[model samples]
Target: MYFGKKNSEEPEIIMEDTIVYACGSADCNGWMRKDFASENYDCPMCGSQLVEEVRELPKIENEYNAFK
Candidate 1:
């Protein structure tokens, strides 16, 4: 028995945080966390409005500017 070897049967851990804002536009794929969104609270893409909703997704870092 080798103590240095770890078991490979352990299950992987997955964390699904509930915090995300999706663009209201049907053709936009922009989304970000509530804490990272702009103060205006608008969609990062398409310059559309955003609605707060609970969704399971990974965290991301992005900056949205409507003046583009």
Candidate 2:
């Protein structure tokens, strides 16, 4: 790695508590935000049942998930 000047203008993010759906299977790591979830849907990665949970996530200013 080459040495370079470190920029100090990186934006700071605010953490917020949000509800999300997580896979019920212990071996699966699939999860999604609440608003992006569909009713009665299972984990998209492992097809396991989903459970509701709360997580601290990076706050969004104006961007939103376009798939919803």
Candidate 3:
């Protein structure tokens, strides 16, 4: 039997204030990163209009932005 090693050095979670679009409907909890949002701010899950908001989220690359 092989024992797994415990790695103490882990990448730190880098949080940033990012723009996002969230569902306006109280019944829905759908949200998405602004960079990934479409021109029409509509919830793809519940067909609710989305509102822009700032949220603290982890840093990630917006692959869609790469083309621009």
Candidate 4:
């Protein structure tokens, strides 16, 4: 799990089960993952170029039933 920097002005909400994939390239430490929406994200770690590679990842469901 990764902890983002906090802002004192806003309420703090903990995020769980946020899965992010690191770049397969050994030299590049870029990472890609879905955001709140199920859209493909580019590199969020190193801002490196991204390629569309189909991956079989576990389905993520909202435990709070927010989508339902």
Colliding pairs, model 2: none
Overlapping backbone residue pairs in candidate 4 total 0
Q: Which candidate, 3 or 4, has the higher lDDT?
A: 3
Off by over 4 Å in 4: 1-26, 34-42, 62-68
Which candidate has the highest lDDT of all?
A: 3
The alpha-carbon RMSD values of the candidates against the true structure, listed in the order shown, are 8.4, 3.3, 1.2, 11.2
Q: What is the TM-score of each candidate against the true structure?
A: 0.56, 0.73, 0.88, 0.34
Instruction: Give candidate 1 regions above 4 Å deviation.
Output: 1-13, 58-68
Indicate the residue-level lDDT of 5 in model 3.
Answer: 94
Ranking by lDDT: 3, 2, 1, 4
TM-score for candidate 3, please give it: 0.88
Candidate 1 per-residue C-alpha lDDT over 1-68 given as tens digits, one digit per residue, 9 for 90 to 100:
75796877986555567677888888997887776666887775588988778777654434453334
| Cα TM-score of candidate 2 | 0.73
lDDT of 4 by residue, 1-68 (tens): 98998877874555555455555556786655443323444455565555544445555555555755
Badly placed stretches (over 4 Å) of model 2 are 1-7, 61-68
Worst 10 residues of 1 by lDDT: 59-68
Candidate 1 vs candidate 4: the lDDT winner is 1
What local lDDT score does residue 46 receive in model 4, on the 0 to 100 scale?
A: 62
